[model samples]
Target: MKSLTLLITLLCFLTFSVFAHPPEGVWKKKLVWKEDWVQIWKTVKKEAWETKWKKVQVPVWKEIQIPVWKEEKVPDWKIVKKPLIEEREVPAWKEDKVQVWKKITKPVWKLIDVPVWKEIQVPVWKDIQVPVWKEIQVPIWKEIQVPYWKEIQVPYWKEIKVPVWKEIQVPIWKDIQVPVWKEVEVPDWKKIWVPEWVKMGIPGEKYLGKDHEGWEYTSHDLWRKKLIWKPVWKKIWRKEKKQEWKTEKKQEWVTKKVEEWKTEKKQEWRTEKKQEWRTEKKQEWITKKVQEWKTEKKQEWKTEKKQEWKQEKKLEWKDEWIQVWKPIKKQIWIKEKREKWVEEKQQIWRIEKKKVWATDKKLIWKDEWKSYQAPIWKEVKVPAWKKVWKPIWEKVWVPNSHGWD
Candidate 1:
């Protein structure tokens, strides 16, 4: 049994030795840079990290915002030159209208000479020309006269009062309202200035580290970085009042007093001795007032409850927030080294053919790095058709048997 166990152990050891990994095959043991391998998605939707998120629109990164070459607005000669302006006169149309007056004919009575008869009292009727004598009978009509007019003497001009019209020029003065223009301040482009950093790129947080920050050419995935900055949120605190209740008992005293009043009943006229409550309400009214006071106190509690909510909100805000640090990648630095190996150990190889015993045999090439000398190629003459076409293999070099020495 002991021999059998020993044989089984030996067989097991041999089996394990055949399958063991080799210790020395270039080892391939080099510090490889773990690239910043991150697969960015709109959202990590596989698990609890799934949440509503907006896709990073990558803001058309290639929109290389090359600064617009604005043509400097140099004031041109035409713009600076003063233009000629002229004042023109407009002719006004003129027209005149003239008025003329013509004299009108009116009836006029010419009196012939009538001799005055003062003292003789004889009727003085002068008819110096009997052929031209007019009728002496005048139509005399007496009208209702005013008292003042009856007192005046007829046909005599004593002291006379006249109303005279005089031409007067009434000058007019008017008030005029004028519009005013207010001065408004406008920003001057000459005063506008931009910083060099702003001119290079849009304003954002700049990452300063040795490794690749934003863009990497080694990976097909576009690089995205997040900075978890701890925000210093502001704190606000305020105080409110807290109320306490105080109750006192004054030996439960009661006062009794009588008062008289002309208390009119529904139908009977009478006097009533009413008990006057000097301080508090009547027992029934006091009970009702106590209930009202209790209700008002509850209303105060409702107002105080709202104040508590503000404190509750402040407690809710005590939660902390986190900011992520920037991610980076290590640079790959390769160095050239000299190495020696056997013919079978050549890493790179190519397939080639050689002829042996009039048959073609494929062979793998082992090219070694070495110095070479270039020789000028020369062409040998052959048949025209043979130069155009390639000849098939016919024979091979053989030293001992089939051919050449």
Candidate 2:
């Protein structure tokens, strides 16, 4: 009984509880027991007996143990225990492949132009002064006196004295110029004589007798021639000369010069050579400046990549259950042996820790130094020639004056 109880206690202790699979990469422990007897119980309640006069009821349950047995033959038993070791070739997990990239740089070269300046010496010409002498002609004047003659007329008058004669009348009385004489008449008696002889008578007797008549004597008157004288008056005429006054007129001449003298002016000139200069324009070439631009590409390296790794695993396990009954108090258990099976699994992963750096194709730039040659020019000063003129003065003589002489 004690052995049976010991066996039952062992079987109860070996009862197993199922559990989920453990996490990866962790260690786990499991329990196992080998035994044959099983101990179990059932619970029942006791009821009270009833009679016609009274009935009784109970509410409590009680535990009870019952033993069962089967008739079978006892078999021989042996302990055979072995550890499960599985050998599986886990193909290496596929490793990840990574591509690397990088950048690179390079250098280039070119040519260009540059500017430069230089100076040169030049020459020039200068002018100077000079003096000269010359002669010229001029005008002069003088004064002088002159003489002339002329004629004129004169007038006069004269008077003279002379004698003149004329006749006049005169009256006069004369006394004793005419005498009145009477002559006596003693007549002719004596002259005439009668003859006496014839008469004889007495003279006396004739006288006395006128008284006596007789032949008487008578005296007779006689006429005879005689002379007479008388006085008379007379008128006379005579011629004489007379004096008178009268006037007279006459003409004369005058003279003078023709013109007068005055002063005058005149001018003179000379010739000479002179110096002069002139300028001209010229053309030449000079240097100039220009701008330029250039462009290029360069490359450099700058990238890194990592290698990949993964783990592989395999599992092997065995399971068995058995039961048996005998007519005696002894129990029995059995185990069977069979072929082992192994499972296969594969995984792929990359190891992120390992890395390597590599250069990629890219553009790179660099500057290069070089030299170029070109033509050079310099300006130099040189002497030049031009046309010029020079001037001088001189004097000479000439005629400029003319007038009446």
Task: Assess each prediction's global lDDT (C-alpha) against the native.
Answer: 0.29, 0.29
Provide TM-scores for the models.
Answer: 0.11, 0.11
Question: Looking at model 1, how many pairs of residues clash?
Answer: 3
Candidate 1 residue-wise lDDT, 35-105, digit = tens = 12333322122212222322232222221222233332221121112223434444433322234343323
Task: At residue 101, give the lDDT of candidate 1.
Answer: 43
What are the clashing pairs of model 1?
A: 228-323, 228-324, 229-323
